[model samples]
Target: MTDAPAPKHYAPRWNSDPRPDPPAVGGERETLSAVLDWHRATFELKCAGLPPDRLSEKAVPPSALSLHGLARHLAGVERWWFRIQFADEDVPMLYYSDEDPDQDFDRLDGDVDEAFAVWRAECDRSRQITTAAASLDETGVRKRTGEPISLRRIMVDMIAEYARHNGHADLLRERIDGSIGV
Candidate 1:
């Protein structure tokens, strides 16, 4: 008698995303923006299909890095780097203060949906600022140090920021559930 074939196994999928793949070849601005946007989408994908408790679960012991916290922190970062620093907009800070600096990650207050909405708005504003700039060489002053920072540098730095946090997100997502992927 022929032996029974091994059963097929399929990985669980928690969410479906229509995020476009970044172009392998493109202009500097286009390439940077696309990659950044892709990272943003990846961040959201990691947090999708989870309840609020799961979203805010500090799955890893001794580290308070939840998907919810990441969402809040990233929203602040997008505002701080893009609007406040790069565009020099006179906007109020999102979730920060001198007395309570790590509020974004530490204090996971407010609606998750609201946090995401704010993040999206900040990203849209950042895109507008980037598009309006004459070149990546466009400069903005550093708040702490009286030095100029270029738009190109900001984009590269933001990409790195997202990359590091995305790594954290991967771990957080995996810990939250068996699901995993880019």
Candidate 2:
């Protein structure tokens, strides 16, 4: 008989969304990027096995936030900060416009699989950009202000943003079912 595919191993009930903790070794770039990657994986893990309908579900009511929306929102944020602001790449907004500023969350009109693809691409690009940077002190101008923003500041801000939003993801995932942790 042909070799059988390996069986999937699901996390035990006691395992609350565990992920690889941030690296204990490496320089600033390595450590910061590792932690960011961990947070990114945590978000994906929180969304693991969720159906599209549930991902799009605004189960909380009165709040437009959904995992699908958060994915799109984070994609836009990644492009905004890393590509537009730091890399100085000229591009249009991936989602949202003056007339539809909150479209990322307010309206779920497209294929969520596509949205996740876009988010994943953006996240990968952001990591690549961070990796290629000469140093954390390298500066880029703020989009709204001509004032400069250091790569270090951007990293810290992004970490904080993800941390806060992951908390939201936690509650959202739990509401969808009862998954928690990381």
Candidate 3:
């Protein structure tokens, strides 16, 4: 008999709200993009079902971390790394300034829905930029240092950034509702 396909492993508990699973085998670009998207979805799922007021709640005392703030910070990061740094686009930085740099996490003003919308838009733009590149080897200048950086490096760095934030999101979500899952 022909060999059977391998069985799926490690199913996520929250099947009702599914997160994208990175391909088991794929090109580097596809793998990186899928992983990043998975992290993005994970972050969104963590914030799901919470009202705007709750979304902005610190949840954990003595810490300014919240789903709303994380959305804002992630959106700014997406724009900063992909649009501004990688594509060299002329766009104003979001939720940040020289004088008030931590505004993304510190000041939780505006509508929570609006923050998520902005974040989704930035993710779309980042994906477009990545797709347009001929290869991961394509280089972009570092605005601060004037050094070249590759698309691969940016994707890897972004993955790390999302991983760290997702961990924070897990804790914030648990403290907020006592719900937890992968």
Q: lDDT per residue, candidate 3, 86-141, as tens digits? A: 99999999999999999999999899999999999999999999999999999999
Using TM-score as the measure, the top candidate is: 3
Sort every candidate by lDDT, greatest first: 3, 1, 2
> TM-scores of all models?
0.89, 0.88, 0.92
The digit string of per-residue lDDT tens for model 1 on 51-137 reads 888988899889989988888888888888888888899999988999999888898888878887888888888889998999999
**Model 2: CA > 4 A from native:** 1-18
Model 1 — TM-score against the truth? 0.89
What are the per-residue Cα lDDT tens digits for candidate 2 across 86-161?
A: 9998988878898989988988889998999999999999998898999999888897988999988888888887
lDDT comparing candidate 1 with the true structure: 0.87
Error of model 3, residue 34, in angstroms: 0.7
Cα lDDT for residue 36, model 1?
94
